[model samples]
Target: MTTQPSPSDPAAVALELERIRRTIEVGFTRTDGALALLVQRHDQTDEALKGHDRRIDDHDARLDTLERGETERQKRDIARLDALERARWPLPSVAALVAVTGLTLSLWQLAAR
Candidate 1:
């Protein structure tokens, strides 16, 4: 009868030990590769974030310039309106008064004649 090798056999123990060693080595190698991939992805994410920050800063600066320009334009418009307001009624009022005085003088002269 053929006998199967038991776990207590020295040859069987050595073979099992070699298999376990090979499995652990392969696991370590895969773990190193995974860590390298993780580091690379982290670096890529960091670069993208920095790029976004730069774009946001540029947009903010542009917006500030636009706001300043709009404020200046609004101030100019207000000054123009103030000038118009100052002139609104005076010229027409003076012309109307002169016309009425001339008409009154003509009427008085005709009545006297």
Candidate 2:
């Protein structure tokens, strides 16, 4: 619904061209600012990721130490069980000896009477 500029109007065409150039310059300036901000955010994210990696590495070291301690505890427990197993037969041998001694005493008393 708007009237077109007359082909003969050089001044109007030149003014329109100047306005478009200014608009494009503004858009380029804004785009540059946005890109700069993006770069800063990316750098910040990289630093945070590095910090996380360090924490993970520290956790791994702690876990390794914990695992070694648990292994030593388990080995000690197994050794104790083995020693207990080896000592199991002496109790029955001592009981047999007591019973035999009592029987011998009874027999001797009967003979003496």
Best by TM-score: 1
Task: Write the residue-wise lDDT of candidate 1 on 1-113 in tens digits.
Answer: 97677988999889889999999999999999999999999999999999999999999998987777666777888799999998787878899999999999999999999
TM-score of each: 0.58, 0.57
How much does candidate 2 score in TM-score? 0.57
After aligning candidate 2 to the native by TM-score, how far in Å is the CA of 44 from where it should be?
A: 0.3
Candidate 1: C-alpha lDDT: 0.92
Which clashing pairs does model 2 show? none
Model 2 stretches astray by more than 4 angstroms: 1-5, 70-113
User: Roughly what TM-score does model 1 have, to 2 decimal places?
Assistant: 0.58
Tens digits of per-residue lDDT for model 2, 1-113: 99888868998899889999999999999999999999999999999999999999999998987777666777888799999998787888889999999999999999999
Clashes of each: 0, 0
